[model samples]
Target: NDWHTAIIPNWLKTIYAEDPFFQKTATVYTIHNLAYQGIFGWRILEIAGIDEYGFLYPEIAELANVVDLMARGILFADVITTVSERYAQEILTPEYGEKLDPILRDRKDRLFGILNGIDTEELNPATDPYLAANFDVSSLDRRVENKLDLQRKANMPPNPDVPLLGMISRLTDQKGFDLVGQVIDPLLRLFDVQFVLLGTGDPHYHAMFRRVAEEYPDKTGIFLTFNAELAQKIYGGSDMFLMPSRFEPCGLGQMIAMRYGSVPVVRETGGLADTVKDFDPRTGEGNGFTFKQYDPWAFFGAIIRAVETWKHRDVWRKLQIRGMTQDFSWDRSARKYIEVYFKALEFRAAETVGGSRP
Candidate 1:
């Protein structure tokens, strides 16, 4: 799906170029994250046996002396796709392109963005074994028991009225920890909410959150280790799920959060933009709270909106039910993927009939 298997397209286009069976095969290259392209020195191309092709895009200066496997995949694949519709568009711009915008733009017509889906059976709140109490949209009242269980596990007093915000991600700038660091102190000071964080990453954030936990022991629950059971508890317990990422390709967290009845509060970019619509009080239409700009205040503003919305119990329950009831299953996404596969096959058929590679 990413750089690790990107070279398969290169091998198909070059090493197996003349083979009748391989010629009929169409490759669909999917980019999960563009930032981690498998780039190496030019000499390594000989080892891959594609040295005869030299560089895929020598016109692009940065790629002149390197073998970028991901670029090769993009150049050779019949169809290119990313995780979400928004990310497919974002990667065409310089801001989010990760130096591959030119090639991506050239192949824009072949590019497709399909929003990812979660495993409904495994993540279903009604069936999750990890949660203290299993509850669906209909039995949402029973969900509070899980909050109390999570509070006890995190060593905090169980308060049903206080909103509990949950975050499960690596502690890094990409995940929007920088914005969190900036607004967390004020958020804790200004609001009567409890924040629970799970997952570990950058040492700086680890140290930062450790201090946050130390300073606000009563209001913060920090676990710097990965625990699958604890993760399910956080999803089932928290009232709001936070995912203010700098750029998310396609976030499964927000979908999983919604499935578990945790309303998402996320930055409007990539999959987060496509999935989590901003909550509107008047119409009550959205599944979550979202901010567009990457500024700390913008993120804080979205959080405040969620916090305010939580005050209205009936409206909040409706929002939760709206999110929980919506489908984010593989059935829809699998159909889209089948379409992409057919489109890829069409491209290959056209090339074969025309006697020219597209």
Candidate 2:
């Protein structure tokens, strides 16, 4: 399948150029992650049926003695889109583009970012079949019962008053496990909080969390593995969800957490910035907690604020309700997708008539 990557794009280009019927159709390419661009050696050109001279084309040659499938797709496709609006802009910058910044900047006008939506119904805490107790914004008492059940399951003592934080993510440097590993034990010692972490990645984090669990058995529950049902339970049961990602293109965890009435504590970068807003004490407006910097102090400060907000039962309840009411379903995102499709068609029509890209 990986070998097909060398052949498919060129084959498609041949089909579009030779077949009038196919030429009339519009092509749209999406960049889900700019970091993984399928960069292979120059030999791939032979597999793509391109001679040495053909590989010397400006578009192919610019990717540095190697061939990049993603770059070729961008050069050939009618329109290019990313998963999030912020990420779309981010990719045009040298910091996040992974050496495709110039290509992305040149095609900025054709680049679109459509924030991906979640399955609200599937993530709804009230209707999630996996939860031990299902409840909605109206029945938060039952929601607390689920928390107690989760605590018992994690063997972290059933105490509904203490703030319980949950995380279901890959424990890697990109996910900010570097900072998390440093601050967790200290945070647990200082606050009356419990954490349920579920994930499996990077032996360093696995050992780090295991050490933390051994030190603070009652306060931390670390599951170094993946379990979908357990993930849903954490979403439904926890008071807050944590995602301190260094750079998130578009995070599904924050959206899903809000859907389940769990406030998100995330670092402000990419989609996390777009979705999670800092709490305004003057107006009490934001849904979740967010920190601007990637520093450990900033992350911990956001947690402190969230824990402080948790102390005020009335304020915490209102914040929970506000989060639960947020709507990030597929309907809006699908409409944007359709709009991009039409734009791609228009670009294709323009290119066909003029025999060049706009």
Worst 10 residues of 1 by lDDT: 53-62
| TM-score of candidate 2 versus the correct structure, residues matched by position | 0.94
Consecutive 10-residue window with the lowest summed lDDT within model 2:
1-10
Which number leads on TM-score?
A: 1
Q: Per-residue alpha-carbon lDDT of model 2 for 1-358, expressed as tens digits?
A: 1222324435445544667766667766877777777877877767666665333446434544677777777766777887788888988888887878887788889898888899987788888888988888888878888788889878998998899999999998989999897779779999899999999999989999989999999998889999998899899899999999988988999999888888999998778877788888789999889987789989999998999989998888888888888878999999999999999889878877877742
Model 1 TM-score, all chains together: 0.97
| CA lDDT of each prediction against the hidden true structure | 0.92, 0.83
Model 2 residue 265 distance off true place after TM-score fit, in angstroms: 0.5
Error of 1 at 30 (Å): 0.5
TM-score of each: 0.97, 0.94
